[model samples]
Target: MIAIDSSAQPIQALRFEDDGATPNSRFPVLLYQLKLAPAHDNASAFESLFAAHQWTPLWRAGIFDYHHFHPNAHEVLGVARGQARIMLGGAAGQALTVKAGDVLVLPAGTGHRCISSSDEFLVVGAYPQGQEDYDTQRPETGAHQQALARIARVPHPEQDPVTGAHGALMRLWQ
Candidate 1:
């Protein structure tokens, strides 16, 4: 177990490996944690872990891309500070706003996106594993198409074909 004492050092980062091994099989459990340091530094504790998958906090001041994960991976987002708006489905779909101490779970195949930001900044914890592909039946909406146009400057690595949602696949080491 990794312990991050924010009271002392403030920002801390660690990754826990799964004992079992399989190329494309999902681990029974995946854990992550983020603790805010004082008002000194804005460093992220999970920067290394998220970097492995090219995932990072959307810090730019503008509407961002809406991303959806594959059908096999489950995602859990824990907000440590500030507030964020979670949009479900296409960009113009339903919106759920989350704040500090709130946890949002995205089951496999659930399409989601993020919007809205605060001055306090935000610390998030996300765990994604397993192998799956995008759902082709559900296509992107006109509003989502329009939203994507503005944020086209940023590149999406694992974008889906139909909706252009971004996500990564899990890889196991022998």
Candidate 2:
């Protein structure tokens, strides 16, 4: 399946604040630069790996080119092919390039959008078991408060998409 680079440094953790327009999460986003096992170098492998960790793999596609957040659920995106420069958080956020074998774990209400990408870019996305049908929210002047309320109510996932119970998510989110 997926093999974490033990020799590599620890996962990159990024924090994005609520930028008035987009209600970002209180939790930091977890970025994992995975080293896929030789025989598991495809989209299916990512899906299988996520599923095994209780993150239900539900979609295979490119990221949206506009800023949006999931207010009701967390998300995990695994880069299966090609590469892309993406913006995390709202207009006042950071841009990151994600290539094959990279995994991004976004907490509920974390804004994200694809800035630019290679033609062959593809990602496999998943959510915690019961959150597969997550909502897509864009910046709306009046909806900010409502979004924040929902975000506050969203529960911490019991398992990390890449690691199970005692993983980084469980530790950091606590």
Candidate 3:
């Protein structure tokens, strides 16, 4: 069995610059790892932690196909069930699999897509407080100078969605 511990999981920070095809940048895409395989998984752990951080629950959307990015707000995705290979940073970004019990904290402008997922794959997505009207912008459509500006203006959540303050999020995203 894969061991479970509080020690930081593999943290990946990817910087995506404007590659002409996609306007993704400024804030490096932060993929904070919470144990992917756990002895006991709390399905509601994300909702509770996010509430504590004031990142209001936005919606429960199974990741959609095709790369997409949020331009107006940062987001947190808690893997509630199943597993999937996720493409982050853009269509050309790395492909990583996340199973139940893993959470990803994505800053504004970070592109992500579900390359493939199990039938049961489920994810609970949330956004920072006051920015519930997040827009999904794809790299296929260029001209993001304005979007990048808006992305740059989006502030970091007061606390990490899953870990609250001083968690891997603040350490990495900050």
Candidate 4:
């Protein structure tokens, strides 16, 4: 189990490669997590620390896909279970693999996507609140795009009926 604590250590700014010779830069992202019982209210925890007006959870299973978010508000992701590979760029950088008990802080304007998942169910507590320009954009690609193209041709639940995207989630044995 790998644990990263941004509180103990100072938060550092991460850079991504840009189209030009110089790299693209942004604000520093601080990542951390907290443990609460099932009975514990996550919303209350967030409210105590920050003022927020909206909150939602983004869930996906199977193979990783591409998505981008230009956050108007700050977000805190609490890994509830399983494992996931989180990629944070349109360019190159280190992809973080997070497991249960891990916490990640995504500041405004950060673009990120999930790359993979483990055998167990994957769940995350997402709190979206407080701020101005949090926006998420997902470019169709890989299985997610393919599913959209072949939705009419494929006739199985595994083949995204709505989109026909293929990924590890479809292969899970019930």
Candidate 5:
């Protein structure tokens, strides 16, 4: 069974400002340290959990090193193996280490990049079912205003990837 330890609450809500080029989010990023059941297949554990909450697990891979964000959709990243140092909220953002069982819920336009990782680093990336058609946006000279408009239009996910409809996202996002 995939169960989150109630004690391992989300770290904090991280909100990034629009740094000119990178149109970061108004909604804060949420990090949840999960305690999953022992399973042989790590990726499947995450995929199952997210799917149960109506979040579609679309990819299995390591995070990209280049800075990027999604303006048309929100995202969830579940750390399935090893560990990684990820930079969150663009060039001026913070770098945090994530290990197995860590889950990050990023709002639309929230910037992120992989700084470093262990050899076995892997993650299950997911998006809201109807909002899976996501676009990756890199910080460019004239794309800020357009990205901001799109980010504003991206709807808040109906449910949290880790928790279901009554998850923290429902409270924090509103």
Candidate 6:
């Protein structure tokens, strides 16, 4: 079943179409269990699942303390270990705690940061459509307008980063 936690007002989501944040696209939602079987902390598990969905692996690292986003492509973050509180949609965003078995499908240009986390807060990140290149754009960049345009041009992934095809991501994203 698709789990929707609206506890953060508009759920685990934030729209950045105002002020000086992202220009278009709604922030990602946290999925409690997108894939029940591959919900462990094994690197092979995450690599295999993302590969099956064709969402190429970009990095395997913990979230950074600084706020950032990708303006060239969307991303998927799987919590391979531990838990963390993330601030999404720039500084004025919602705070979400995600643990192992949880997945975050972030749209292009959605801001995110690791507010606080446990010692073993490992994450496996992937990009859509076998993409590998990305730019780390801060919300206060001078090229903010260009970033927004780039975000608008980014194509939506044909498959979900976790479940592919008709997964909850497809339903929520489209």
- lDDT of all predictions, in order shown? 0.36, 0.88, 0.74, 0.42, 0.87, 0.71
TM-score of each: 0.38, 0.93, 0.83, 0.48, 0.94, 0.82
RMSD of 2: 1.9
In candidate 3, what are the lDDT values of residues 1-174, reduced to their tens digit?
323233556666667666655566666666655664454444466666678778887777689798888888888888878899998878767788988777777888888899999998888898988878999888755456777778778877788776567776677665
Ranking by TM-score: 5, 2, 3, 6, 4, 1
Over 34-85, each residue of candidate 4 has an lDDT whose tens digit, in order, gives 4434534433343332322143444323223664544234444556556789
Model 5, 7-38: lDDT tens digits are 44756677788788778787889998877556
lDDT for each residue of candidate 1 in 1-174, tens digit (9 for 90 to 100): 212232222111212221111111122111122344545233243333343444433332222345543333444454556777766544334566655534333333345556666766465544332222222123234344432332232222342111123321222111
> What digit string (tens of lDDT, one per residue) describes model 2 on residues 1-174?
234442353699999988898988889999998876554556888888788789999999999999999999999999988899999988899999999889999999999999999998999999998888899999776899999999898877878788777788998888
Error of 4 at 92 (Å): 1.5
Alpha carbon deviation, residue 10, candidate 3 (Å): 4.9
Error (Å) of candidate 6 at residue 91 is 0.4
Candidate achieving higher TM-score, 4 or 5: 5
Model 2 residue 18 CA deviation in Å: 0.6
Candidate 5: regions farther than 4 A off: 3-8
Clashing pairs in 3: none
**Measured by TM-score, how close is model 2 to the native structure?**
0.93
Pairs of residues clashing in candidate 1: none
Candidate 3 ranges with C-alpha deviation above 4 Å:
1-10, 35-41
Specify the poorest-scoring 10-residue window by lDDT in model 5: 1-10
Worst 10 residues of 1 by lDDT: 16-25
- Model 3, position 126, has a per-residue lDDT of 89
Best by TM-score: 5
